[model samples]
Target: MNIKFVCFSLIVMLFHGSIIAQELITPEKAVSLALDNNYGIKLAKTDVEIAKNNADILNSGYLPTLTGNAGANYNLDDTEVGFADGTNRVLNGAESSRYNASVDLNYTIFDGLGRSYNYKQFKETKQLTELEARETIENTIVQLFTIYYKVAELVENKDAVSQTLNISKERLLRSQYQFEYGQSNKLASLNAEVDINNDSISLMNTTQELNNAKRDLNFVLGNTIPEDFNISTEVDFNNLYDKNELLNKVKDNNISVLQINKSIDINTLGVKSESSAYLPTVGLTGSYGWNKSNNNAASFAAYSVNTGLSAGLSFSWDLFDGGSTITNVRNAKINLESQNILKEQLLVSVVRDFNNAWDDYQNKLSVYRLQEHNIKTAQNNFDRTQEQFKLGQVNSIEFRQAQLNLLSAELSRNQAKYLAKLAEFQLLQLSGEILNVEY
Candidate 1:
């Protein structure tokens, strides 16, 4: 069956414009709301944006660095000067002032292609962040779908329990009438009343359980709506995809696999980044400067000013650093190998998980189908017994048994249906298609 149809069948709802009325929400609406309001998804998006910013070309090491600096200094202290001709002078309040300013430019001419590797690594990191966001969205969607279906199942079960409770109430009334008119014994009326009380308690418990399920659904939707709501009753069990096909897609599309692959690329680049330490680093440095100094003495004062321009090509080769660079390169290679192994392991796990989910889905489908047939038979039996009870051909115990059987069959069927849906959802998530779910 089409995936959209399957999702639609789970939460088919109609909306109206009335504040006092129950709000009609479908699984699609809930998912959309959660996507908009979920804190985890918002944070994941922020991380993607940050990675994108870090990957910018300007942030790469290829860009030049320019800076301007200026400084002034003043000093006052006793000073003495002596010349080679044996003339000596001394001043009590000797003062000196100096000023300097410069504009410098520095750029890396080459670094063994380390900048290129850095750029590639950052770009890959950005892609990884985007994939992480996709993972977050997929998780949220699966969570919403699971809770929504559980609420639907509980609602159905509550209805069945309510029906049984009504039947018990009616039986109690009939038994009371028969005893009041002396047509039946007091024990019959007492047993009927006891049955009614038991059914009422069961209904109350079911109602509470339904309410709790609704509350959980509300929480999954980021608590944007009221909990007192009804959900779609339809359960669709249609499997159309092949296990081998899904397994093939998992390696390329699964978020964990993609992340591991990216990590391997980063680690490979890390080896390159570390190998850069072996080669000489070339840089261009240039500066324009102005300087002035003045000295004050009692007899004479002197001052001088100078301006200069300088430029140079600098290179550094770390011939040896006690074997640290070699160790780092070896470490990086080892990390890359480890990451590759991890990717292979994850692929195996993904395939295994997909198989398990597929098998579970098939098994649940079988159970759901069986329970569906049981519902039909149980319905027929209950109808027959109900009629026989009216005709004095069946006892109260027999009629009650038929009612309970029909209810049990319905509850079991709903549970199996949701369980199958859960398994199907897992398969989609494992294949990285859960994020593609349409609203």
Candidate 2:
């Protein structure tokens, strides 16, 4: 019955009559839109930028600090004085004024190389943020493609159901015509009508599922308003990956593993930074100042001014802090140990996930190949049954069963195709290759 042509025609009619105005979205376009618009990726990139800003040496306390101070005062008072020689003096409207200004600079000379450790820590933190951002991008792309393929799968399934519906409709018409001519019984026509009803229900269910999948795809694309769109129904099954190579790449390049490694490095630096606290801190301090005072009513001096520059080297030692430094250093070491343990655990998990995805991919690919063969056989069987029914050599039930077998095979093939594609994407995501793929 040339079901492929029937399915394609029905899909064309369905779209033209129902959703002809919808935009067609390609996988590349979906990925590009998600990269530009997805909120999670945007936030992750923002975090990377913040980390980059914090990576400055200034933030690591590697630079000198300069501060300036200035002040002025005015006073008015009445004064009375008694001298040691028994002489008394009284003054009215005594006025005084003072002004001062200073600029100071302080630079840490040494602190057990803590500044260097801090700088390294900041750089590592920046790198960690960048990895996190990459992880976000990878995750978004994976989700986008997953939903994209789901839409494609549902679209194909809907077409298959629509083809069955068309077949059932034709069968019903033939049965009615035969009964009118006294060739088929009333029961035969009634059964055809019931089958048509069932096919219609299946078509409706497939359509509903397709619609829901499209909505989910739109959400993942970060659409502000849901828009009706058609996705390319082509499924690519050409990916070839070696398990050993994938495992090696995941060990070195997986985003989560890399992030944990960075964390461990940062923690190591933390340990060094805390340990530095036990050493004496040496600093260079310098200041320049100007001071002036004036008295309107004074016996010894009417005005005075002072200006000076001072410089010195300062040192301080944390001789004791009630075991606080010891506690902090111990805690930092413990945290470093914890990060090491986490890295070990993460490596194990990464390997486990990759293996699982790899197995799923292989299984799905095998199933898809089997379904491909099964569909061909089903199509041949349906064609034979269809020809025999035209000659009245096969009953209506036999023909319908063949029709259902063909429909089931088509659906299974469609499902297997997409499931295999999804599994492939999962492998890419686990290996962190999803980010490196050309959209």
Candidate 3:
């Protein structure tokens, strides 16, 4: 008849039921599993590793390249030769062979600091990848919490419905006994039966919703099969967050803003790298080569050999390439400017979202508290109505009304509690602090 008694009874029933034997998944474990198993997180981490590898000096055009070459060729054919003195000779099966080998090295000595800027850009790209990975991790954790809370909410609703069903069963039994003794009319007994059926349907629907919520939670955790488990129906959140502090943290740590800032740095480096193309490029080139030839036809010597080492300095300046270099430089500068604008836009959007989430959190928390108070009032009213109904001072309709009122209040309170908790998570997420939550 009252919320407190119903809760106690529901707990006793659950203790004897299968729920006591089910696995209890805590928030911490859920997040840990998701981090290990989620596909998005795995790919993000891979991208981060690739970016780190790309940041190496070998990829930055700073190291010299060495190459080796070797070749051999042979020919057999009839040959004829004529001298300037009017003498002619002919021979069959003339044989000739040639062999060559070389090793070359090329190095860029100077490129107007383009290599340095490119290397810095690589490092910045690596940082951007790391930040993107962090964002993925944060988003996954937020999603995990959302589903976790949803399961908890549905579980609470299921418990509430179970309690209501039990009360309806008891009322039906009492009504039957009173009717047999002629202390209650047949219509009252019939109404109680109908109420029992309605409660049964509500219980069934609540159970179905709880099952679906659990399945969804399993998917979020990357579970291929649904796990039979129970969740703690407790929604906890920080009630003392300072708005100004959160806003500052958003500016400092929000993933989108950080990503955009990193982009701006990379684009600035791009501008420098492209501008370097305007200056002359100085390079060093060296090679050691060997060649040998053999001929059996003997118009001259039978064999000749040549071997040498060569080195040279090379310089080139792109005075004009149909304005391509200038265009590239201009485009790089434009990209840099665009990134700066994007950062500004992203900051504005981040601030607006944070403000909205903050307000939503506060509003939902107030609503939850109001529902808490309302449930207490509903409980007191139900208790009085239950006592009056026993003494026949209240009709069956009035008693049922009180019962429904208490059930409705309990459901509303559960919903409000989880909604407020979700809003709190959103706030923390905006501040980039959701990853720091302790289960």
Clashes of each: 0, 0, 0
- Residue-level lDDT tens digits of model 2 in 285-389: 999999999976655789889999999999999899899889989999999999989989999999999999999999999999999999999999999999998
User: How does candidate 1 fare on TM-score?
Assistant: 0.90
In model 2, which residue pairs have backbone atoms overlapping below 3 Å?
none
The candidate scoring highest on TM-score is: 3
lDDT tens per residue, model 1, 1-439:
6999877765554233243367778766777788887777888889999999999998998999999999999988787878679998887778889999999999999998889889999999999898889888888888887888888888888888888888888888888888898977887778888888888888888888878878887876778887566666666555488777888778778889988988888898899998988888899999999999886774254887889999999999889999999999999999999998888888889888888888887888788889889899999999999999988798888888898899899899889888888888888899887767543
Once fitted onto the true fold, the runs of candidate 1 whose alpha carbons sit more than 4 angstroms away are 1-20, 83-87, 298-301
Report how far residue 177 has shifted in candidate 3, in Å.
0.9
Candidate-wise lDDT, in order = 0.84, 0.88, 0.89
lDDT of 3 by residue, 108-186 (tens): 9999899999999999999999999999998888888788888887788888888888888888898989999999889
Candidate 2's TM-score reads 0.90
Model 2 worst lDDT run, 10 consecutive residues: 221-230
**Model 3 local distance difference test score:** 0.89
Model 3 worst lDDT run, 10 consecutive residues: 219-228
- Tell me the deviation in Å of residue 38 in model 2: 1.1
RMSD of candidates 1 onward, in order: 7.2, 4.9, 5.1
- lDDT of candidate 1 at residue 176, scale 0 to 100: 84
TM-score of each: 0.90, 0.90, 0.91
